[model samples]
Target chain A: MSTMTMAKALNAGLRRALDANPKVLLFGEDIGKLGGVFRITEGLQKDFGEERVIDAPLAESGIIGTSFGMAMRGYRPVIEIQFDGFVYPGFDQIVSQVAKFHNRTNGRSSVPMVVRIPYGGGIGAIEHHSESPEAYFVHTAGLKVVTCSNPNDAYWMIQQAVASDDPVIFLEPKRRYHDKGEVVHESKPIALHQARIVRGGTDATLIAYGPMVKTCVEAATIAEEEGRSLEVIDLRSLSPIDMVTLTHSVRRTRRAVVVHEDVRTLGVGAEVAARLGEELFYLMESPVLRVTGHDLPYPNSRVESDFLPDVDRILDAVDRSLAY
Target chain B: MSQPLQPWGGPPGATPHADAMTASDEMVQLLTPEGRRVEHPDFAFTGDDAEIAGLLREMVLARRLDLEGTSLQRQGELGLWPPLLGQEAAQIGSGRAVRDADMVFPTYREHGVAMLRGVPVGDMLALFRGTSMGDWDIDEHRFGQYQIIIGAQTLHATGYAMALQRDGLIGNPEPDRNAAVLVYHGDGASSQGDVNESYVFAASFQAPVVFFCMNNQWAISEPSTRQSRIPLYQRAWGYGFPGVRVDGNDVLAVKAVTDWAMERARQGQGPAFIEAFTYRMGAHTTSDDPTKYRLSEETEAWRRKDPIERVKTYLLDAGAIDDGWLSDLDAEADALGEHIRSTCRQLDSESLAHRFDVLFREPTAESEDDRDAHLSYLARFEPLSEESAR
Candidate 1:
């Protein structure tokens, strides 16, 4: 097991995918020489050559639209949207073409491609840079949405998403790129669509994904000092939700709090809360609560920390759930 | 071959027909609207009598199928139908130009092309009849599903061309080893962002793709003039590729032009564009009304350049087919029409479970649970008698 940052882990994972398949191609703006804005694909162009690691023109729709054609022609293309906000230009291709290729062709052709988007807020960056656009993709059927919080998952999930036959919207937590964690390359650690229980507790269940997973885990740690047991579950896959693992945790804890960096209305948290309510209606001690960003637009970076859900906000939600 | 560029924005050039009938030097023609054999400096109709007769048969059968589709829609058998009425030559000529190894990405109205690619007439109508969303085996037929979105298939064709290049299927020494991609769209689709981006990508990558745009004078209610300030083929020049306009009603010209473009792509000469200048004699679809927008005089002018009649006229004058052969083809068209009408009626809508089954290659836990839940929900009610259900 080697300790590395999420960015390095992702780079290593992408390199592994390229090495595993000759048909695997990496295409994006500035991904070739500049190695992406975050340097997540650094040294990949040099190692894989310009053919495999291609620097595409500054057109997101063209990148995805062509990638769909290549996928139809039996090539697995891994595309990178420079930022979460920039993905909108290619939104039509993603929602219309990539998402529907498999179903549209009646299972004859499936686009085994991956769209990598660096998402979420808290780095105090510019507008459109720090945004959580996972809900839009998660809401889209035929698309599998997943995000990684730590380095280990970043490594394994990147490879897994590429290996998946279905198109995957792979969200990377830009804020957590510097966070280091041990990645065991020999082991998979977990399934691509399953959620993992980061902390075991009995007082309340804290459900989160991507950047919020770290905040929820931290909340559990702080709650432990105050004689409160809060379980933290990392919802690795947003589309599938991994309800089996979530239901088990909620049934045992009897109280739940969902956390996300996305807006409170019609967000990933709402889907989790609704499902938990329907499935675990009799088992809950209190109504499911959410500790998430406000419905307003992602505020300026100066006050983003206030807008973002932190350890204090998560603990507050847990306290409210325990009180019920 | 090289005629003076027809001055744009002129007083209709004294021709009652729209833009394509101006007899410009830029446009290539093998056979004129008067059924007179014309020679082009660059391209010629190299096919013999048998090939010409075969192309004429295909155009006739396609026209018959299109009329049957319109009749069915009028009879409430179909939700809608996009008739390929006047664009028969453009479709058959370009569709036949595509070799067996090549791939084709067609817009929704390419029923004639779809039939030529070996897809049944009934299968194409199934999309309009609401029984299927095009479940044909793409790899087998080398044809993509009928793309309903305007010009999105251009990008797909470009990408597929790039894939062909990567697969070592282009610029091959052996003839059969080489492959290219053909994408069909219309004049209205030429203005789309995706189509323009496709040109950029295809040029930058030197992808082997032939962009066949049938400039049928109208995009529903809007005229082609609204879509472009110049000839549609000229758009390819700005993208660093060869572009040519052809007399769309002349089947010989379309076939020759498409053949030249496809061969260029197969030789890895980069992407090219061909504007099949024709007219949409019918409405864009059963839903549209051309009378609200276009002039009767313009439609009447184009009627003289009917794609089918010109071919029949040329073949009969050339002594390639007699009255007996024409009657036999009419009987064959009748049989095909009956087959399409019966098959469209028999096309069944697949079950919900089947839809869920095809959504993902590997079934997810959520989809499985949802399918099971739906099944149990239906199972709650007692099964009605099959006779009553029917």
Candidate 2:
């Protein structure tokens, strides 16, 4: 076991992927010698030559479209969209070609590529930087969306996404990039798309993914001091969704709350709420409440903490659900 | 009044065409509009009578398919069709220059190129007919699937060419073995950022690809003049690659220019660009009306310079084909058009209900549930009444 940050774990995982496949290519802006803005791809270009670790032009669509072509020629390419908002420039290539290639060719061709985006807010950034753009990718039919909260999950999930035959939108939590944790490489890695139960409790269930997993875990810990039990479930896979684990937890607690930093309307939380309503109709003691960001755009960093859900807001929602 | 700006590479006394192109900077030509054989400084067409006749046959068939596709849309057999009427030479010339080993990335309007790449006429119509968005086996044809977004395929072609070069295929000793990529787009699509970025990557990586832009003068209602300040081909010179402008109405000229560019790319000379100066003779698609934006005089001028008329004229003037051979080609085009009409009309929609089945290699639980829910909801509807069936 080694102690590392999420950024370091992700870099290690990317290096392993490059080593495993000779045809794999990594392309990103400022990712070669600069090693990405967060240093997530540091030392990779040195280890792997510039030919394998390419420093692409300042065009996102070119990176993805060319990656799509390379994938057609039997090369697996991992692309990095500098930030969450930056991915919009490449959205056409992603939704139109990268996401649709396998379905467009009826399984005859596979685009085994990873589009890594550092998402979510907390770094006191400018507009277009601290955006949660997961819903756009999750709504896309052909793409498999996933995110990791800790270093261990980051290491395994990065490798798993690169290894999968499907094109994966691998979202990294920018705020949690520096959070340190243990990564036991020898331990059995979890499935890329399965949700994991972070904490076991019976009073109520807390559902979250990516950065919110840590918030939900914190909420559960604080709630225990007040004689309340909350089960925290980390939904690693947002698209396929671990319905089995979700139903098990919700059915046991009979009350639930979903948390995320994205907007409440049409966000990942809304989808989870709908699924809970469909699967656990009469079993629920109260409606599934959501502790999430406001429907408005992510506010400026000055008021972002207020706009984003925190431990207090989650506990407040949990209290309301228990009251119902 | 200020003097005209000389073309970037033309000589001092050369008269420029449309901001920058001289007579010396003019494209390669074999069969002129006057049915005369001409020579070009960069390329030549040395094909014999049999090869010329074959090329003529392809042009005839492609024109027939294009006309029939528009006819199908007018007859309500298709939702839409983008007619490739006046750009036959631009497509066939570039399409034929490609070897089977090379890859092609085509825009949605490259019906002629798709036909030459061995994709069936029926499959080409699938997208407009509302059946599929092109599910052809790309490996078998060495062609990228049809891309609807304008100019996006150029990036794919550049990347594919880069991979081909990296694999030691370019400049290989094996005869007809080296591969290159040819990407097709229209003048309107040239304004897209992806297209310009493609040039950067192709130049930086020295990818073996040809950027074939059919400058058909109109991007729907917008003219090519509105899209660029200089001639379309002259823009590539800024991107550090060789670029040329060809007479799109001259089939022999287009073929020669494209052939030279492909050969250059295969020889590890990096990427090349060809801007085919042509006109969009028909409406952009079934939904558009060219009369709203274009003038009859402009269309008439291009009609007088029709690519097919010049080829047919040259063939007959040279006694390369007889009256009987011309009649045979007409009959064959008629037969092929009839088959296309019949096949499109008889397209069955029963299989469309299962389109979600092939959406993924293994259907996710959410998608599977979505499919099941939709199918069951469809079961609630009553069968069509006799009067409403039509």
Top candidate on TM-score is 1
**Candidate 2 per-residue lDDT over residues A104-134, each given as its tens digit:** 7766888889999999998899999999999
Per-residue lDDT of model 1, residues A224-246, tens digit only:
99999988999999988899999
> Compared with the true structure, what per-residue lDDT tens digits does model 2 show for residues B1-390?
656656565335643444222223566567777777787656788787677777888888889999999999999999999999998888888899999999999988888889899987777787789876777778898878888888889988988997897678898777487989999988988899999989999989889999999899999999998998878787776687878889987888888888888988998888888999988899999899999998999999999988888888888988999889999999999999999998897775535446576666556777777788888877666464544776
lDDT by residue for model 1 (B1-390), tens: 545433532233332223232223378888888778988778899999799899999999999999999999999999999999999999999999999999999999998999889987667877898887887878888999898888988988998999999898888789789999999999999889999999999989989999999899999988899998777776676677778899999899999989988988999888888999999999999999999998999999999999889888888999989999999999999999999889888888887777787788878989888888888887766465554787
Residue B231 Cα positional deviation in candidate 2, in Å, after optimal superposition: 0.7
TM-score of each: 0.95, 0.94
- Root-mean-square deviation of each candidate, in angstroms? 4.3, 3.3
Question: Which docking class does model 2 fall in?
Answer: medium
Q: Assess each prediction's global lDDT (C-alpha) against the native.
A: 0.89, 0.88
Q: Report, to 2 decimal places, the DockQ of model 1.
A: 0.80
**Residue-level lDDT for B375 in candidate 2:** 85
